[model samples]
Target: MRENKSAVLNRFFSRNTFRDIIDSTDDEIYKSVILRYVKNPENKKNVELISEIYTELKKNYRNEYYYKNTLLNKLLLGVHSINTTVALTEIPISKSKADFVLINGKAIAYEIKTELDNLDRLENQINDYYKAFDHVSVITCKENLALLENKLEIINKPIGIYVLQNNGSLSIIQKPLKYSDSLDKNIIFKILRKSEYESIIMQVYGELPQVTQFKYYSECLNLFLKVDLDKVYELFIAQLKKRTKVEKELYQNVPYELKFLTYFMDLKEADYSRLNSFLYNQFGGM
Candidate 1:
């Protein structure tokens, strides 16, 4: 398969595709990609087809999904336990969207630059993440490693780097050190939801801001700015850690290829049962 066909693989691995399977909804993407890519898919279970396609994507394409799923599998699940760690995807921070974020004791933003991706906005993306996070890293394939390293040299902060080798292993090219000089309180405040910052205000100030509904937000911001930035960073990490929690047993039984999707799907027990049934069933026709 050519690299330009990544969109087809992207659709095949998307949340919408798996949502169709769990909800028993029909989508043409499933049948089209399966028939086009997998041989004798009719006889194989959905899980097997998924594994085969994932392997192909890893080997040939190495698109953004492959990088994220691999990180979640290798770093989040492989190195860190789900019970203690939280992984967030596609989080908007300042001018850029953070590709993947891992929050254990400290939060680090991972910006993925696959071979298919360009570095036109990498500097801006890295700068945006530092406002809300202390540690930041860029994960890219071996082809882009030298360019990324050269790019980082002129950038003032200590940003770490990792290479996703062709063999599907994450290698730490440069370890990131904690840098807090760029932490902006207002940017950090904006990253939090109303309830999150409110909780922080109550904890630190012991009272919610008392103002009109229109002014309440600004007043809360003013109050938040008064708190120490380091303290604010700690509270921010604590709040984000509560956002996404997964069902341990259900997540464990899910195929490795689908772990990233399953983690973000916010699956209920009934949904898990439905997905399990779908995975075990042969394609038959769809």
Candidate 2:
């Protein structure tokens, strides 16, 4: 127990230790962990049957990545697959942002709160999401489930709640109810880049304002404000669908541990390939 694989894993991933590994100019701990994993991946991950070991280390930072990887795994296994384009991550709404916002026919925002995260800003985050999306879910670990439930009751928002199970899957505690908000068209338009707005306007109205860069924003805003809210929403969803058709091949070669980071977080192809090679190299015999 003193120097076993799990003990090393727990310590290596602890908040302070991880910080030291990151902050150090040249930390041997980082190299040793990676080398050990490359040589024998299974030994470090003994928590599958050792529930208490996992429970004690649940609050670690790396587990934040692990939890999301689990959630992505859950999404892949369930009705949601890699087929539909996951439009955005860290989607800015009112003030805060959604962790993952999947858009195809419908927009569903997922807000992740790892065990290490505080719920202090959750209310405000939920409120911001409501302004843009109809369906919003707060994904947290089992430890925070009750606190989220109580907070949900007080806020009275039809936000969904999901708990990360010990088996590395998500379970819905409260199903989210979608409520259509009379969203400001200006706000909706703000979500789009200048060229996206321009493209939509050209397609819909067959015209773009003949103005200088300085005057272009005001002109675009005027034009967007005149467009009906429903039309704007429809066009937004369509643009999202068109813009976000992900290359399935990239995900085809993705590592299970980095699934969320690769797909959901939009890791650069080069970086993903590097990570995939580093991790999967061992799988095939490094």
Candidate 3:
């Protein structure tokens, strides 16, 4: 008489964005929900338990948000490691930004195409990502997978494809061929800040241009464009990875869904504190 499973799922999906989930850490409201689906995933959910929840999600939601959050959960719970840095979301590149990006040994950009999204910008998105990332993949539902694959081939691109499986796990259908050509230096440095670019120039190339303050950005861009891309990207990844350092407690215990929000979204200190309050109580932390 308490409630039904679908009712619970409906409420859960409504708690979609970061603000909805962490309004108050005192209630431990998100506590059980996270532990069941994500925390200590293997030790927490058996085959029967996993199947029940996965089935409900597929039946109830067939959009980009559901698919991406599920894939994020699986990746964070399954693929993440202490040595490897768990990373960014909606990251800007050139004219476009990737839906999510993970950094460890190499940069991998994931573009999400739900049944609800259009393919008009897929090609353009992949172009921006390939220049900056070592590997780029599109994660789509089955309905869009074939169409996306055909479009990728029509354009003669080597982007990979991963189909979100019915059971809420991601399977790599096509491996993204590693891009080996020299990247556009302007596009690469454009993703960095003034300080970041200045730091890289000083460290790797020995010095920055002592140009007029008005021309500093242009001169720096030109100098960065002239530097060897391999070395530039090495410096870029190092700089990007350094940003993932969070409060040690938060780093160890933040929810997979909230980790991006807690670390990279640049929330005000009050909101960050709200999210941090749950750190000491997480199931598989550290």
Candidate 4:
């Protein structure tokens, strides 16, 4: 006879830390579960059965997970302080529900996959997301990292990659890659408007041409708007050599539109407000 899998899940969820595991310390519980299951493979069939039941629960509770992850990613990316509007569970171009959409004047779609599912669907979902959104990301646990690396070779599109453990800790496994010829104007504009253009310049140049400009722009705009300009400048210049080398070897002959970006980094303190105003006008400002 089939065991009452619900009973097993109920028992698991009833633990005082289950909610904490799901809410705050997911990676710890995830590692614990894997370790416990590995140590006690005698109960392998039971574990698989329980996992199946949890899959059903996850499907039913996907919305809850989606919202939770949005909140989680927001905190992880420090989105709240960036003045960007964030939305959750947006629809993909496929009209299937995307797990999260972060719009801080730029559209970023996030799809969350748990341990129960293969990442094949995620690859397809991210592809669809890119068609409808400006950026695409997948949030999964470390157990799925191998799968993402394998898929990355086949899907050449630039997509943000993040690991969201059972403990709710998020680590950027793969920063967003750029697949388009067009510069992400919104991100570019934000970086130009920032007081820390010098720092933004250094970090942005550190990445490969396809990724460096967009990622650096987004990161600088997202983080430096409130920090002291001097610190930002120091940090930016400190990494300049590394960025310069990366640009020469990996992103030679960078597009003219993006090259204009380098100019913002060299501006005088008195010139920042005017340069920002110029950039805002050029990009039609967010």
Candidate 5:
């Protein structure tokens, strides 16, 4: 397939594609990818075909989504309990968007450099992430491991490194140590939404900013800057954990391949039911 065609196939792991599937809405990209990838679509259910396609992608593509899904499966679900952890994606920090963020007791930022990705912006991206997150790590493929290790070592930062092994396991190359030297209150404030920051202010000071709507943001930011940075981080994690809470029982039923998408989809109970049905249905049956 051409690059353009492969681009269409990549949508299989996207949230919009799963949303369409759950809603039973016909998606051109889904149909096209399925038809092209599945050898005999007559007997295979949607879920089976998706798993097969994902397996192939892991071997060849190894795109950002593949890294994220593997992390969510192995680290989030396998290593930590979903009930105790919260995973966020594409979180903007300073000038870069963090690929994956896991908030357990403390937050860790993961910057994924897939085999297809270049190291051009990695240093700056890691710097930006440290403004808000204390622990930072780089997750890459085996090919990029040594280069990343050497680069990070030269920088002499406490950043950790992990390689997504071909056998589908995360190998810890270096464990990240907590480095709070770079934590900036202003940058942390920038990551929060108005409501989240407002909640933080209320919890800490027992009231919102005492200013007009025009000055509300500035007043809140000024107050946030005055609060202890460590307290702010604790509040930050508490606030973010509340952002995406799913029913544990229902989420446990979500397939491993779709865990990343499902976590960020904000799917309701009805949507899960529809998705469950769609996953088990054959192309003809659907």
Candidate 6:
């Protein structure tokens, strides 16, 4: 019997491609592969592999979603759908990266700390992020939520706090703090939507836009299927508080289209310029 060299190469390339897509910084590429694997029943094995890879990678890294979910799961459940590793950004407080930044159309800063850490230092970190970015959020475990809440109330900042639980779940408990009087309920609702949240994260952080519209919705559904709505709601509240400032004016009350967009693409605002240039060039600069 002849050796199936081509078959071997095909399998190797398939697995490698899948790994590369998951590890890729390009959100579009990542989204496309993720969607394809998710939608096709035949690709279930690959999807499971990707999930396993995510879990294994996080295990190797101490700063995994496991740590984050443990502190916040009680308050925020929707986090299960988010790729925590990719969503979090470490930026400098004093020439250091903020612990975690949610970049959609704009940048939102967060400073994560444990209960054992110095409270004063954490406060200082929050101040630093506020100075650099328009909005700032503080994330802590359940043990510190009450203390942080009281402290924030005393300081009059009354910032929102994120509580990570031991089971990789999140609970977002608000402090009734208001940064500005102008609050839009629709934006808040949109933020609460899992699809919208994923879309925003993909756009700002993932930097990829190839996932199809159907796949985005499917992913959102899958996330919800595996998690609880209350948990998701809590996380949304936490995320909303963290990313409160809307730098640009949004004429649309809600991003209804975002739900469909989630299926096949991962888009970001920063890429608009590149997309525009590409289109312009393709259309002879018309």
Q: What is the C-alpha RMSD of each candidate to the true structure, in Å?
A: 1.4, 6.6, 7.6, 20.9, 1.4, 19.3
Winner on lDDT between 5 and 6 is: 5
- Model 5 Cα lDDT, one tens digit per residue, 142-192: 998888887787767799899999988999988999998888899888889
> lDDT scores for all predictions?
0.90, 0.64, 0.66, 0.45, 0.87, 0.42
Residue-level lDDT of model 2, residues 73-142, one tens digit each, is 6764355767764546666776887777767568878888876678898888887777777788888888
lDDT of 4 by residue, 1-286 (tens): 1134333333343333233332333334333433433344334442242344345445433223333333443452344432234343434345356665555434566777765557757666766565445467777768888888778668777778887655545688776754444323232333233444544544645432235765855565555444444444334323322221112222223222222222213333433334233323211101
For each candidate in turn, the TM-score is 0.97, 0.74, 0.71, 0.40, 0.96, 0.36
Candidate 6 lDDT, 1-286, residue by residue in tens = 1134223322322324323333442233334434433344233433343454334323332232334333222222133322221233444444345655554433456667654454676656655555445556677767777778777766556466766554445566763232433233332333344655675445334633346877865554444334343344344445644532221222112122111111112333443333323322211101
Q: What is the lDDT of residue 136 in candidate 5?
A: 97
Better-scoring candidate (TM-score), 1 or 3 = 1
Error of 2 at 131 (Å): 1.4
Better of 2 and 3 by TM-score: 2
lDDT by residue (tens digit), candidate 1, 240-283:
99999798987899998999989999999999999898888887
Give the winner by lDDT. 1
Cα lDDT for residue 164, candidate 2:
85
Say which prediction, candidate 3 or candidate 6, comes out ahead on TM-score.
3
Quick one: ranking by lDDT, best first? 1, 5, 3, 2, 4, 6
For residue 56, model 5's alpha carbon misses the true position, in angstroms, by: 1.5
Clash count, one per candidate: 0, 0, 0, 6, 0, 51
The CA-based lDDT of model 1 is what? 0.90
**Candidate 3 C-alpha lDDT tens digits along 68-108:** 56655666546776456566777888889988877878777
